[model samples]
Target: MTKKKLNFCFKGSRDYIHGTDIFNELKNCFNDSLNYENTMLDLSFHGIAKKKLDIVEDNATDAKVVVKFYDTNDDKKTYYLVENKDDIVCRYDYAENKIVELSKIDLDLGKINLNKDTSYSLIENIVALNKSLLENMFKEAFGKWYFTRLQLKKIPLNYYLIRLEFKSNFNFKLTKTEIFLDNESLGFIYFSLV
Candidate 1:
């Protein structure tokens, strides 16, 4: 069998998992796919829910992580990793492995500072009401998959990106991963199943 690469670099609140656990969790998420739709769920929420996620987990670390986010819609599929400091933003290109200096932007304080804390929820809830259900959903879709990149937006946002690079171009499943911003539900990552 050909070798496949499964790499995941989670930023924000979910970065503290043991390397083994992270690998195992990714394996499980891809193995138990047959009965995901029938798993038992018991979930409830009180807000309008700014975002919804199909699967999620709450056992991560608080370390600084670098996530790589690629724009699938782009013809070149340009990957982006934003770094902001002192009101300056720099964008990196994965393919060329360098920063496109022309894309740099300088701001003078108004909104969206990478060093300041802002209050906004990117994801509200993980779709599965419980852990087992979440596990099953992940497995069924990612059992034979690998990752290509981890996309991250501007700094201080408390969220990054995960890019799946599968083993082959065969039957695959589409799913979402729950992301958070400092213990609060932030948003969902719709995994590309290609």
Candidate 2:
């Protein structure tokens, strides 16, 4: 297997882990395909979430994290990750490895930030997130695709983006994550899924 170079470095703090859990508890929001070592997760629980995710914001000693997200449409699937900040957003496309600076509109700040909370659990949140949420969201977005200009042709693909909030703690790792549409006109699709 080809090795992937992770950009972020360790913050150099001792972690406090308990129980028989084999994995350490610091992480960011990402697809299951992101199986990297030296990562942590802050599991937040609420709503129709699928799979366990690390709370992405306001937790790590240094406010920084490596986050990953994915999108699949018909024959193609793309995965992305970014080392980001609340004030700035960037995305790395897996196919191109190109970094794109994201604007405020690309991220639905008004809707996602308000719903998610501050605190999180280390384990319960992961388990609480279920598959139904994914199916429901995709189901809702499929029918309501907004027509958009794609490659000089009008295509209806609901582009999505995920935001991560990492904690500013020394040892405890937490990541808060939320997904938003590329365009606000598609906002209904998200709530429709929920």
Candidate 3:
């Protein structure tokens, strides 16, 4: 019996917004409605597992946004707020780490400035947002397996790369998966089952 290795890698840019930056922008947009210090204290107390803000600029005057927050609480809940232009379309709370569509919550949104520059914080947020997706995709491609190593690197042209290696006892073939965002090519997933 021989031991085999499965390698999965994704390379490209998703242009994700930094968690802290977006949180600050939200605080500013809401004015006195959102208390900065108190919110920060609550987040510190509960701990932040993941945060991501994805903004899509439709035209010169219109934009759509999807903001998500995952906290390290006992419930492991995920909260999402979706906004189109200046109006919040809907809000959802996913409890127990399950993706369920629930009732809506009201949130007022104002003008938000999107940052296009790439930074380490943005990379970390992107990783946090996609970690579960990557795991699910890996399982779909090669069945359930535990990864042995993980590596992340910042590359040129505002792109980030991630690699995950898993040890296996079965041999398979090479496979490739393309990751996209709004019909645009964002990255790719390459893996070899061996």
Candidate 4:
């Protein structure tokens, strides 16, 4: 089979989605068999997730995260992030089919607005919401995990806002992604990045 790679960004906004929501969406993409029973589509979130450092509290917060996803069964996928010497980063291990936990995420507390009280409240609320969502999905799916893939019908032009399209072979659709500078969400793209 021919292979391809594409990066996904959120449709719009600099805001971050809670880690729980990310995990849930990821679970749906993995567990959904669509109508094709006996097909185990192992899905994983591939991107950069930073763990922020708070020396005073001695705890880490899930900070800015940018991820693209793909089926672990696909051998041609990869993700790269510019590592910061100061902060701890967590990433997915596609080849081994497991999450690589971060030792710690350290950041300059003053640099990120998450240091503000109101902003921190919002972040906490979102994280709570994400956790609830993930728990529900896990219960409903009986702990099964699946990932989404792109089913492209045509070669996309490298023009403005190029999109790779495909149908979801799972029970879930209407997916969302992160928005980054100079990138647009092409709906959904299958395959993986090398």
Per-residue lDDT over 122-189 for candidate 2, one digit per residue giving the tens place of the 0 to 100 score: 12121122112222223434432211100101112223332322112122122122323333221111
- Worst 10-residue lDDT window for candidate 2 reads 146-155
Identify the runs in model 3 with alpha carbons over 4 angstroms from their true place: 1-14, 35-80, 83-194
lDDT of 2 at 56: 35
Instruction: State how far residue 107 of model 2 sits from its true place (Å).
Output: 21
**RMSD list, candidates in order:** 21.2, 18.7, 21.0, 19.1
73-161: candidate 4 lDDT, tens digit per residue:
43232222222234322332121111112111122211111111221222122222222333333344433222223222211222221
Candidate 4 lDDT score relative to the true structure: 0.26
- TM-score per candidate, in order? 0.21, 0.17, 0.19, 0.21
User: Which residue pairs in candidate 3 collide?
Assistant: none
Tell me the deviation in Å of residue 68 in model 4.
15
lDDT of each: 0.24, 0.22, 0.27, 0.26
Cα lDDT of model 3 by residue, 1-194, tens digit: 11111111111221222233343454344444433222211111111112232233222121222222222232221222322223222332213122111111111211111123223343233333233433443455544321111111111133333322222223434333333322334433233333
Please give the ranking of all candidate structures by lDDT, highest first, separated by commas.
3, 4, 1, 2
Q: Write down the TM-score for model 2.
A: 0.17
Off by over 4 Å in 1: 1-135, 138-142, 148-153, 157-172, 184-194
